[model samples]
Target: MKAARIYLSVLCLSLGFLFGFSPAEKKSKATWIWQSEIIGQDKQQVLEFCEQNEINLIYLRIDMNKPSDYYRSFIREATAQGIEVHAVAGHPAWAFTSNQKRMMNIVGWVKKYNLESEPNERIRGIQLDIEPYLLPQWETERDRVIREWQANVEAFTEAVRDETGLMSSVALAFWLDDIPTPDNPDMPLSKWMIDQFDTICIMAYRDRLNGSNGILSLIEQEMQEADELGRRVLVAVNLKKDMNDHASFAEEGVVEMNRQLALLPEHLEQHPSYGGIAIHDYRNWKEAAADMPPVDRDHYKGTYIWRAETIRTEKDEILAFAKENDVNLLYVRIDMQQPLSMYQDFVREAKAAGIEVHAMGGHPIWALTESRGKILKLVNWVKAYNQEVSSGEQFHGVHLDIEPYVMPVWREKKEAVLRQWMGNIEAFVEATKHETNLEVSVDLAAWLDKTPTPGQPDKPFAHWMMEQMDHTTLMAFRDQAEGIIGLVENQMKYAQSIDKKLVVAVETKESHEGDFITFYEEGRGEMNRQLQLVTKALEGYSSFMGQAIHAYEYWKNGKE
Candidate 1:
């Protein structure tokens, strides 16, 4: 019966080869590694190693903190090299928590990512690492725990399939051979798990194939069962030193590990289920020794500023974050005081790194008749700072964040304040162009169009601000993308007529400003997704430049 089973398994695998495996993957070796720590990787070096070693797949952790485009860039490059990439993550409780909302969260995120990503960048599969046996409740409630875990596994896999429409896989321990199921105590654990997931990554964790605990010994039966069931089998090795010494090739190092890995397929050549070798994680295996620069784009991606003090204090961090988010236009504050050099230094580096540094600072009073000179001083100071620095090492433009409604003058006489603010802005705009050819941009509340003009309340403030400045950053401030787009729709049409570029600004800062104004409650991922909606709505409009996130400090710390 065993011989017959092996023969039938071989036949099934042969058919799988005929119908399932991609020709490129079949011709190339199916080496893979898990990138548990993908943050600091030199993308080129990692891809080079994979190409040289014939690594066909990488199990990358979804960097939920970064934007979706972040993963898309790397995945696109990997797929171009004929390497497959899958989103991988696990937490045992994720599968069984009330509502299993966390599992749904993962599924939702991956689904959105796929929808936003290109064909090559879309995930090939989702490798779930829900190690239920590792949970504390498993030991005390063995039978019940096993049953719940089995159910969770099946449920989670189903969700991935039905929701994401992507192939699903799971990491399993090699010892899970014959643990009985609650439904049928005689059922093998391997059989049940293999049935639940499309591919089983066996955590073999042994260095050699001779002893009872050897890598081959552990998976010999697994491969046979895999062949019989038409399930794909992949053996994994631990690269970390803290694991059982004999369980990994940590002491032996990468050279020896690669040498041994080369011989794996040969030993299991006859096993129909043998797919490939997957190193446990990139972080550990990479030390066995050997290796993303960001991709540049052609867009005026920008951010708004409510905190120049924070930028000056945390310049390095702010600069790094700017590059991570691919920000080009930087709206920061400038003063002739103590931190003057900080401004110049920031502008210098920004120019060197192909980023624009625009000086930004304004008060509501600066838009009144008495304070017209004050706003000009800010602009003149920016012009002088530009002259002080090298030709390119200066403020790219000047941005005003003066919102007259915030002043008591507006309540006292709304139209009177509007007329005065318009007059002050007219003088400031003319002076800026006359003094320095710098492009002037102002930040305005998105509801400016809805706000009634003083005596002529029928005509919105948007009518009076025609060609008032080169660009306008509308503070749409809504957390959700749809609401934000709605806020800017009328302004977008007006801007196209007036020939002023409009930047739809969203609030990512956690502020008590308003309930729906800021995405402070939402993480960077959601914020990024929301921005995509803004871009899509206003795409192809010369007047619609791009979006501006509320501020850096709030966006950086909002996740906490």
Candidate 2:
């Protein structure tokens, strides 16, 4: 009998492979479309999004009131693009025996729709998202509620089993494994649900992947149970903004979310029952993606204007030089002592010439605890200036070039200096938090990634700064692209993980520090050539914004 069973398994595997239905075939990428009317409103939008995201399966919410043509047309188009559409409907109240009819109505509708539609337009599956745990009765009469939920699920699955080609699935909470089955105390509710449904989508919502409470760990039991039963399980993650940071990737942006999702296959492919990943719903996921800042790779050619007097004395010459060098960003030094009209006129012209002007000021003393007021003074001055100027004349952002390491106190009290620097940054960010349009950015040394935070040894100071600011300009200050890339590699990875931006800056002024530290000796052609190489090399990193020259004076002089 054992030999016969082994032979049967081999035969089944052979047949599955021959028919292109092997259990180890390509994993399915699914998503939920909770708004049924979206199909009737703009079906092409949904189809195109699915195509771009490589979604092969969709649990489309069913609204029986709509005309059948909507589903037919959407499903037919999806089918042509190798996508499957499944009818989905359910509510917490549907778990009650009295609401059994409401549950049956969905099964009945899907059956009727599939019967009338052509092969390509047919509904491929039915998924019920009933969550009895959300009902108050489940808390008071837990046993009774469990019995009723099980009965409803049994009935629903039985009804679906009669259908010819329709599969049955359920969106189940990952914690259901802790609940014992009413009929078989040794079995888990999750296991029972897996047995009853053709597929189970474990709602294992989490932002990270490896912790005790992460997505992988939360769905381990469910995946094991499904594999033992030879069933399929799709891991689901929430993208809704309503969820906490740990529960959803809404705040992490699309690039980080994709970075996390891309690792699911490597960690899950070993399980025979691992189906794939499913995003919570379409609308929120689309909105979260849209919120991400568009990456204009290699687009920003920037240089600093360190002297405010230069903008007044050589306004036309500066604009002409900026245009000639394709400079889009100018970190113009803010001299609070100078007249505000000088900055207003210069910024207005810079805007007209298609250049973004950011107010810049910094000193090594600004990192001292006693000098925190100086940091806030700069922030307040920029804020006040922005409020006084027209939109075209306002500073686009505030950029700080503070190098606290240059202070003598940094050598005597390194940790104290780091703490004070962090405090100053916090003050700057707090001062400008209310300025909705004003971006807060700073210049950071590339090697800061090696310095650990005071208490959190695992997190680098560079990462913490990236988390607090809108973006950071890394002072790589290396003449060659290879050296510059190596210097900023760790910070680049951290920036990508947190969805922050980094602009790599190279020194052009002759440096007494080291020959490798500045491109001043390399001249304009070599600097431009090396920067182009850096851009091409770091093209894969979404965090890499572009390259920046140290200052307009030296760069322009070198060009001469």
Worst 10 residues of 1 by lDDT: 19-28
Model 2, span 291-335: residue lDDT tens: 876534346778999988999999889988987888889999877
TM-score list, all predictions: 0.46, 0.53
- Lowest lDDT block of 10, candidate 2: 15-24
Candidate 1 TM-score to native: 0.46
Best by lDDT: 2
Model 2 misses residue 385 by how many Å? Answer: 59
TM-score of 2: 0.53
lDDT of 1 by residue, 1-560 (tens): 11134643453344334433222113223334454345335778778877645577788777576788777878889899878887787787764655366666767788888998889889888888877787788778767777767766777788788855688888888887857776787877877888777788998887776677788887877788788888787888877885578888888776456556645654775776777678866667666654123323324677755555655677677767877888878888655453554564566556545577778888888768888878867765665445444343468788888888887877888877888888888887876676466888888888888876666777788656646777888888888888998888877787788777887788776578776878878778888888887888888666888777777767777773
Poorly placed runs, candidate 1 (over 4 Å): 1-298, 305-312, 452-459
True-vs-predicted CA distance for residue 542, candidate 1, Å: 2.3
lDDT values for all models: 0.72, 0.83
Clash pairs, model 1 backbone: 415-454
